[model samples]
Target: TGINYEVVALMAIKTELQDHYNVLDNWDINSVDPCSWRMVTCSSDGYVSALGLPSQRLSGKLSPGIGNLTRLQSVLLQNNAISGTIPSTIGRLGMLQTLDMSDNHLTGSIPTSLGDLKNLNYLKLNNNSLSGVLPESLATINGLALVDLSFNNLSGPVPKISARTFSIAGNSMICGVKSGVQPQQSMSRSHRIAIICGATVGSVAFVAIMVGMLLWWRHRRNQQIFFDVNDQYDPEVCLGHLKKYTFKELRASTNNFNSKNILGEGGYGIVYKGFLRDGSIVAVKRLKDYNAVGGEVQFQTEVEVISLAVHRNLLRLIGFCTTECERLLVYPYMPNGSVASQLREHINGKPALDWSRRKMIALGTARGLLYLHEQCDPKIIHRDVKASNVLLDEYFEAIVGDFGLAKLLDHQETHVTTAVRGTVGHIAPEYLSTGQSSEKTDVFGFGVLLVELITGQKALDFGRLANQKGGVLDLVKKLHQEKQLNMMVDKDLGSNYDRVELEEMVQVALLCTQYYPSHRPRMSEVIRMLEGDGLAEKWEASQNVDTPKSVSSELLPLKFTDFAGADESSVGLEAMELSGPR
Candidate 1:
């Protein structure tokens, strides 16, 4: 009787590992399917998709037979006592996204074959006894988001990798200095003394020449320092966890901010794609019209606060650079770009974001906003929340970018600014009129973002194209009320989406974008509603209340024909400083 290939491969893996806690006790070879076994997750087709056995007290060598599971997407076997070489055959799992084998006692050189994982997003092999030169192939994987190989016995020069985040700090043997031929044997004592006397005579001459050169260099350096924005700032000062990069480094990374490398342009500045010397990919945002009055200390303080607001859903500040005439913020390059770009663009003759991914993006963006609003120490108000600011990681997970940038730019001002900063249609009514923005301002934008995700169109552009008098929000509300919501969905989704989920999402969006800020739900409440809790009650309550006359009459119209000339697929809109309605 023939056995299933996956079952045979899994049994082979079980045979090699010594599971002391009996975690693999149920991994019976007699069973035709290994899908039900603990630590194993399978797809709908019964193919193993993930194998998670972390901290299981498992030991022994990993079997080469693991390569047989070609459909595996994740393999997390960290925090164990696994020994012996990593099987080179693991490279066969082409669909792998995450491979974490950290905090283990694994030995032998890392297999060069690992570079073959083209779809990989995260690769963690830190805290291991792995040795030998780092493979150049690992640097070529464009989809890799992070690669950590710290605390290892690895030697040789580190390869420049294309990952957004790459670390090899704890590997003492890895360095940039190359080995060279050693000097000849030491001279006799008499010969050494003669040489020393001869050197003494030359030392005086050398010292005099060095002093002249030093003085000349100091003069040039002082002149350059005068033009530095952070003139009094020490490069060594820690700006929280952020790395302070030199202006020269950034210039070289972005090819002197070449126009060809431009990723996107915003009201604040233009963002350029860059590749660091270490081969890591990054996005460098060069701010325009930076206010130098904030001074070095103030700039550092503001940046430190922004860096401290760390969350998985928030875009991490990789580093930053400041010069006399420029201010730049460095962030990890998002491979899938922003939700706005993805919505407008197509892949392989179809929409980039499918119905399921769109749903995931909606929930993920909400969670990120929740972190900024309620979880952060001082409670960060996004000020600008829209599809463009929500970036997609390699795995298509949503990461809220530019959360604290408004505060960074307007450092001297409070959250309530006299000059409003936001996109046109996405800006809240109260914010546009009064220039006083609260968390509810962000809520209003999030509501529009939901509609954008649903329709796969820019809010302003959608209104123009449809020639709808009330704008995208009004059209959606009208369609929703008339029970014709099916007409509002993105045509690309076809019949793939669930009708009930679509109705629930539209209801949530309507509740969030109500005319009155007080009627909008908090991010925490929004999350609950998205997860299928208390939405109907909130929607019903919102309906019973009539729109406040005071604010409804003052609400700015969402239509803007002037912006129609702008690229619909652009990553971000220019931040307009609104004193009043145009």
Candidate 2:
């Protein structure tokens, strides 16, 4: 039964997706009923372009017949019990976008014939006992975006693609000249050496041809992610305009990253607050688990994918470090800390997050999320959106942070299957149940933070009234039942607020927390709502207009800090220990 009918059973999870399964109903490999389900996906020519049930929890070698899906774009099935060599005929899948066969107990070196797949974007063959000098031909394929060979018994100087971008973090025997952000002096020396060598050995046009070919190769590889054929990036583009820095330079600037330099910590990494010799401050992030449990390849891929992409709402990537095992990132330090700590919960035991301030923060955060989900090239899904992840600058401007679980999907793509990964109370119900994360997941998390801002409550509080709603649903229910909705307001505020604006915010919060993901508004729509529109026309019509901006400028330099009056050392690592009037 190796690579056979058992694979059909796995498809049974969703009745709609598996309805056409004909073979597994009878376990017959030769039956016509199983043909379509065996391996399927339609192509431009009205034919299947993908199929594979490798291991499929089956216990036998794959049949050579597996080669039938020549037009296939994806073949995935590993983490199963199966044996024997991979079919060299698999090289026929010229259109394959992804092929994974990792962790199966298989034998044999990878067939060099696989090099013929110029369109393949992803290949995984680690954990198998394959042996051979790794394929050099792979260096020629520009379409490949991911290649994994860490656990295999393979050897050879890793392919020498100039400044080869890869992660060999865990494999002790795997070695290569690891890349890093370098000084201009080294770059200048290499350029001089190359110029002298070229003067002695080659004519200008011949070198030009070689340079053009090298560029074309890079263009091909980038197509896997930046797949459009015509939008090639130029090597002369100014990276200096990005104004990034080196991690080593940052280390020296921050006293070798003293503990006192730590300003914040989140799911993705630790942020150390540093002041440059010239007195300019920055946040240096040394990724906590550079060798993340997920795998170092993914770590590098994440850095590459997110770094090059820019958005004003995103915390800018000042620079990065990849020397030895050091995987650090530097970003401009947001002087005001995170929104959770900045909101001055109480002023002399009274709420300092007045109606106006809370409203502004809400709108600011929505704009940032909107930019990520709706405006970027490949839309970004910010998997985490709690108050802690929303950082603020001196002006109380919000910026989204900690994009570890963020995904950059094709502009038309909507959701992807992933394991549940988010703080409790902030995760959407569907994500928790089905593991299908999407933009709406961020919406749910944002909704909870909205409540936290208004009520000064957290995402969840078990200490609340017994029988209270266990989550947002419960919070809404409790507020609805209590009748005195005013009681829900943060006590520190003590009604120095616009009741009309406050009610509208609560309604938006409720809309976001509804049981169905479809019910939540897109961040774009949320931005409009927060920008003083459509929540309650009846209220907005009679409500006083927003105060004129003339006097607000005087409010700048408001002298805000997590340790408002306390001196430096008082605000230490145990942030929760900081004592304040609130």
| Best-performing candidate as measured by TM-score | 1
Off by over 4 Å in 1: 1-236, 408-415, 548-582
lDDT of 2 by residue, 1-582 (tens): 455332333233212122232323433444433322322333324445444443335445655545555656656655555567777877777766567777777777777777777766567777777776656666666655567776776655566432233433444555453234333545577889998988867777788899999998777666654212222222221221234345556778778878888887666566788787778888888766656534555655565445433434457666555543456676778977777776654567655556777787787677667656644434578877887788876666667777734666654546754344566556665665555667888888788788778777554542143244233455564565566567677777776877777667776776665556666677756765665656665234323434223211111113322221232111102111221123
Choose the strongest candidate by lDDT. 1
TM-score of 2: 0.50
lDDT of model 1, residue 28: 88
lDDT of model 1, residue 23? 77
Model 2 error, position 106 (Å): 51
**What lDDT does the true structure give each of the candidates?**
0.77, 0.58
Tens digits of per-residue lDDT for model 1, 99-183:
8898899999999999999877678899999999988778768766568999999998777677656788788899653324444
